[model samples]
Target: MDGRASFRRIAAVLGVSEQTVAHRYRKLRESGAVRVVGRLDPCYLGHAEEWVLRLRCAPSATLAVAKALAQRSDTYRIQLASGGTEISCHMQTSDQRARDTLLLDKLPATRQVTSIEAHQVLRLFRGGPDGWHTPIASLSPEQVTELTPPPPDPVPLDLDDGDRLLLGELAHDGRTHHAALAASTGWHESTVRRRITHLRASGALYFGVDFDEHLLGYSSHTLLWISVNPAALDAAGAALARSPQIAHAAATTGPTNLMATALCSSADALYEFITTQIGSMPGIQTVQTAPVLRIVKRAALL
Candidate 1:
């Protein structure tokens, strides 16, 4: 789904019949094992300020707080932390003041929340659930080139109301028809097509495949908080980024400095990944692991 190829194109590339490709796609979609959704590059869209929040709350209030935050558009990823009393979330907002309201003013007002620690995301090495690499190398380079769409022109940094409306529609369904988008935005289908093309080419948007990892043989999902030597930051981050098991990785403000999310098929597999792949990397100082018990939200979808 990375390229959202047509069944015919994909079949041609894979040397399979179009009917076979169509059948497989239908099954995956029907089983709720996959979904293609559009995502925004927050920095390019003027929502540059981003944060990772870890909240310690009363055990009884954990689900309530997580569900409440998941309902907000500004929040991206929310997970129940390992201990069950803590919740971790990633959020972005256009302005610092608005970010404060979402991260500070709002949570403090909730009686269930006991404490909050917020880390400003410095530079994103990779973004998760949606942006990670896959172990399978399906399409060949030549086939991929044939299926790739023409690049769109860069769009203006400032988005008009209509642009935002179109983005919202894509966030709901990346493959949404142009006619449907036009109906929602009150624009001509041609205009909708132009806007989408521009937004994509400008590096302001991306499409991600969302699904239950279990369908892909991944059952354990965990977050890694690692502190590496200042000189080794780039190396450590790069190593993690290349791992197909890593769903997300970023350098952030705080003692830990680096954060990553990874998935494996089982608890033993997770242990092996941490010890062999992650631990063997250079400049690693301290490592803290938190298994995600439940995912409250992923991407823009609930």
Candidate 2:
């Protein structure tokens, strides 16, 4: 993803000014809809090993455990379960040798770990769903909140097939030329522009993103499955969602009551994050760690 490219480089490549690049970047981030994270080679970053841990705990305890593990600096992520037998966490480290000596040997020893599985990812396939341009007849209040240049009256628009495709094209690549999109969609350039304007006003368009993880030298990735006290999940989930490094957090139907995806610069930083930032939160119970050995597909939409 050219997402990792610096502002000056982006300007040079796109033939734009540094100021324009900076301006666009700001709008993207504040909207909570932009993330240009760096990409990294697990082999190069000393995060060569990938492990998945499944934990069995009380149904009410998933979030507590998930949040506990999420605080560890080594924990790159965590996930919650609604009700399941085992909570799962994905973890990655630099090499097999270290994995055996440190993660496999020492990591589990640090917590009330249940079961663990490890696999090597031969390749990664990140896909973009076809729905970007698949126009939805309506926009929810929360989705509307994610948009910028806020709609004057918070109105949702009625979009046809052409409108959805146009919006999808822009969301996929905000830099897509109106003229080119018009040619492919069989609409006039002006019509395309007006349609975009309407969608933008209605908060149906998203053209902001950030994707710079590996390029920034983050050496480790982890996803934790936590079982928390059931009564405490809603509050706990809301708290975890506010952290910047916590890329994504959701409650799943699986065993892991709570799940959190985290990114950090080094193993030590990851450790600190998990212990201090996460563990310190209220209502936490148990924590498990699973490093992302290979990222099948890590990005979300714009």
Candidate 3:
């Protein structure tokens, strides 16, 4: 669903009053059960590279390290996993200097960090603007069509200082009204709206939902580090991306070239998915599963 859609449009599709929809949404947001956030594609920012970092830390220091990483502007999806002994997260760096500063200097110097491994994301088979599709389908085809935004245009958009200001506000709250955006960006409300539309159409910005998956009946979250034959890497990634259990999948530079995050209802359900969906795939050499113990940060900054 388009996060920018008005309450009236959402209520019309759900067969509810706009007031009810608005009230419910506010309640969810205030309770920290759900949030809508605007995310920028790092690729659009020149020289930016995304990496998946795995940090093995002392058991007693894992939470501290994870929390520290979560506070960084460049890190998101921070998780404590492997019996609270490992930390995993996605990091974006604007340039080689930024990358080296962390990967080579900061992380290596951390006393509690016993080891660090960084995998450069080569290709995204899922995640990013595409997002994860819930296994449970609630909307009718007609309603889905009504809510879906149009395909983004292929044109490139260069971000200016004013555009960055607008994005900074949206990053905090995607549903912020145009007047607030205008105040932040120092642009007229009409200009802010037009710029937002242009940014989305250019594929530079997208809105994503951050929610507590457990509240929605999904209790199992596991990360899979998969080693696949180079010959079948693309095919294997595409297959993983098609699985409803996978929220994110990508080809990365590492011993395990393919990585995925699976969300399931229970340990039994996750076992079934691994054995049937992943185990049956061709060219799969090895699979390492890391159950996420806690999420310190999601796709958006907290």
Candidate 4:
């Protein structure tokens, strides 16, 4: 109930054995689905430049623009945001030269480009799998999972060394079949299945498809940083979380206190979603939208 996340309390309420809960929780961390990775300092990492790509596209060319951006490994995120322009991505590179080459020179080459601009990050704070370590602009509050306080669920788990190897292989490639995983990880099919179940049950594993919004016709996307009243954040966050358009939301430090990324069917739809949906809230003082041009890297990248 309170923020005191003791295993005993958690397990009791969830109606499962303490060991089961503990094991599953460890698995959640192991799986990339919920990680605790750190956000490196861009300057220290030699990524001193942060650029935002803003685009104005010709009618019905959303797919074309996204495809062009996706071809490069640097394209981190693409989403349809407000207006005719798409917020392609917020990216970081080692220096101005790389920024220019990818964000500037390469953008003009796209035939559908109506306009493009890359804005640099002056001072940035973002977190990755490690919260706040990803990017201030890409911040998305993790789902708050509240386990029902009860006697915990009981599930058997016996993962030996070989079984653990199988888990590692599957964690890297979810689609890998038991047979293939066995061959690669040096485990048998039955052992792989049992271990996989243990990992999933213990929260050490997860599998899902990664969505590339560009392919889904959401041609516009951007990251917005907003300063909202602390007292009002609870209400503000609840409201914004309700919007289907918002892909991610997270809290941050400094003038821009809240960061959110979204994929909209149209720029106007994005505008309405922000201005009408989240903006209508009382505590929101200001909002700055930076359209992403391309993403150089992401926390999800293995």
Q: After aligning candidate 4 to the native by TM-score, how far in Å is the CA of 165 from where it should be?
A: 4.2
Candidate closer to the true structure by TM-score (higher is better), 2 or 3: 3
TM-score of 1: 0.88
Q: Tell me which of candidates 1 and 2 scores higher on TM-score.
A: 1
Tens digit of lDDT per residue, candidate 2, span 142-168?
433343233223353565889757755
Residue 301 lDDT, candidate 2, scale 0-100: 28
Leading candidate by lDDT:
3
* All candidates: CA RMSD (Å): 2.7, 15.8, 1.2, 12.2
Error of 4 at 66 (Å): 18
Candidates 2 and 4: which is better by lDDT? 4
Q: Which candidate is the best by TM-score?
A: 3
* Worst ten in a row by lDDT for model 3: 41-50
* Minimal lDDT window, size 10, model 1: 128-137
Question: Candidate 2: RMSD over Cα atoms?
Answer: 15.8
lDDT per residue (tens digit) for residues 4-47 in model 3: 78999999998999999999999999998889889897656545
Give the per-residue Cα lDDT of candidate 2 at 153. Answer: 31
Residue 57 alpha-carbon offset, candidate 1, angstroms: 1.8
Better of 1 and 2 by lDDT: 1
TM-score of each: 0.88, 0.50, 0.97, 0.47
Off by over 4 Å in 2: 1-157, 208-210, 298-302
* Pick by lDDT: 3 or 4, better one: 3
- lDDT of all predictions, in order shown? 0.81, 0.53, 0.89, 0.55
